[model samples]
Target: MFITSENATPVFKDLTLVMPAVAVGNVGQLAVDLLISTFNLPRVGYLHTDCLIPMAGNNPYATGKDDAGELHTAAEVYTAPELKLAVLQIRAPVVKSKSRRFRQLLLSWIKASGFSRTLVLSSSHAYQRDDQQLQGTPLRYLVTPSLLKTSGDAFKELGWREMEKRAPLCPERLDTGAEEERLYVPGGGITKGLYMDSCTEDVPLAVLLVFCSEGDNVPDAMALVSHLDDWLHLLDNPNREGKWKIPTSWNLLFGSGIPPAIF
Candidate 1:
């Protein structure tokens, strides 16, 4: 269930919610990290449930050594009121059997909060793409009908590629009149399921994802954030002339230090 800190339950009405899928290369989560770090969003609350694998760690957005001891949960919420943006940074994978339940809880919260729209950042395996998907940029986007009506023009203006739809399986069957095109996201963890659920539930949602493989994906995260910056103008200087502030918590990303034995 979603729980807000006593003093952090600021109104989220009409705000945009951004979250990441624990997908291939963890690109989405890393990109979310960049946003949190760059904006220094403050923690608002966390989702408490058995759906996600239990995990905890030092706060990844802490600004000083004194704050380094703060513990962060697997699924935490952060907000930037100035931008009217709320982000859910998920650090662990959902338990397979409880995935559906988690999605339901999430949708419920989204509805109750009255967010105007939501964007999910995710990634898929590059090798799974068809020939056509390989012809252009690796980045792709998907928007529900409602969201398309509102933000479609902006996407077109940005020259963003819309994810391709595939013909439904068992095309041989003719009773259905015609084979409907379906969105397929192989290796995207909960991405496809969540997006489809949002569409069916009439939630105005957009999915922005990149095609990538396992291994070093920091570059992919950077590219994904840049793509988002084009749409949201999160960066003050769009020309890359300005510097972004990195969160001090990132200092412990690999670890505090190497072992003396290794040295």
Candidate 2:
């Protein structure tokens, strides 16, 4: 459920939503962080749902002491009205049993809010990639049919490779010659399910994901957000390099000083 700040409801009609899928290396989340920090979009509401693991902290994007003490929860909503953009940043993993419920909740709100389109940023395990997936760029995309009808031309011009469908491993099913191929996004938490649901429900949605390992995924996040900018043109970097400000909270990524005595 969306609870607006100070009990003030904001209109999201026709806004384009970009959300993160809590998956491998949290690349999607990190990329959303970059977008939020870069744009300095103001927080509008909170997604108070049981679908995610609960967590809280001081404002991660706080620009100074004045805003530094603001309380932040696991899931929050930010919007840049001028850009017609809204972003949902998920800072925690989903509860294992409620994955389906979570997707339904999101779709219900999105449809109710009247977003023009939705984009999910996510990542999958690099090691799971088949031979064809290993070559070229690690980026992949999937668009629901509803989005295809409207954004079809834009996709064609982008020259992007669509996510591949692979046959299942079960021999019995294979022997039956089931002609259907499945969209498998291993390590992409709720990404495949959400896309499938959107397709079934006739929602205009697109997913952009990267293949990456679990180490420090800052670079992977960089690449993913760069691809996003290619489509949305959200950032104003003229040189196509530098200028993205890293958030203040990331300074302590690996925890504390490690006690100088231990060193």
Candidate 3:
């Protein structure tokens, strides 16, 4: 599971799982381990965009939306179009800005490869499931629930008052800096930088595996897809006023269809 520089290449027999950071390498090291060790999946390819180009190491964290690095070349050997499916672990909405270009290129390659079944894996916001409200009203702190949950401590370590752990006995949720005026202290705790967090973990893997079974029970796959889409839509729309709800057409997009070939 600890795929160090020594033994980084291995051929998978059935399916190929692709994620953006898995290409740059270090960023999704843990995730790659989970996919390979936990699920026994193989590394087929990766995406390396411009942001990832500069910091490109053997396998660095994903800083861009479209850099395939060695994966582009490895595609033919590792990612065969005839494979059963391709699992793309990209939590949508969170990467909406960068994902557009990334997805475009991925879809293009898929079309070229002629692969029919593709699963776009994503996780919902943790806040949506936990029902946790934003500690303060700040435009910058507005993030998906999954991001917050996955990145539990990074936010606090960054010294953002909004994420600071208040006194356990008398917890006071700090507002986005604008609310700091309420506390007459200067520099009490405020550091600034891009705050990125990913908290959700349940939905996608489960959904993906249901299909990975790849059995004749197509109805089971159909049901799981329906369940997943329903959850995602509910998280996408958080209504503070009314009871949260998923859209009616959650299953319209999924079924037994083959994945888009990205080989």
| Best TM-score among the predictions, by candidate number | 2
Tens-place lDDT digits, model 2, residues 48-114: 9999999999999988999999999999999988889999999999999999999999999999999
Minimal lDDT window, size 10, model 2: 236-245
Query: What does the lDDT come to for candidate 3?
Result: 0.28
Model 1, span 1-263: residue lDDT tens: 77887574768898899999999999999999989888778888999999999999887777668988998999999888788799999999999998888888999999999998999999999998887899979999999887888998999899999999877557768566556776889878889988989989999999999999998788898899888888988786454444455566556555688778986
State the lDDT of candidate 3 residue by residue for 1-263, as single tens digits: 11212245433323433332221111122232223222323344444443222232222222244531423211112232333434343221223345345434544554444432223222212132211223432111222353346543654554432322222222355444323422111111111101121112111111111111212323332333333334323223242222222222122324545667854
Candidate 3: regions farther than 4 A off: 1-32, 38-48, 51-98, 129-263
Which 10-residue window of candidate 3 scores lowest in summed lDDT? 185-194
Clashing pairs in 1: none
Q: List the residue pairs that clash in candidate 2.
A: none
TM-scores of all models?
A: 0.90, 0.94, 0.28
RMSD of 3: 19.5
TM-score-based ranking: 2, 1, 3
TM-score of 1: 0.90
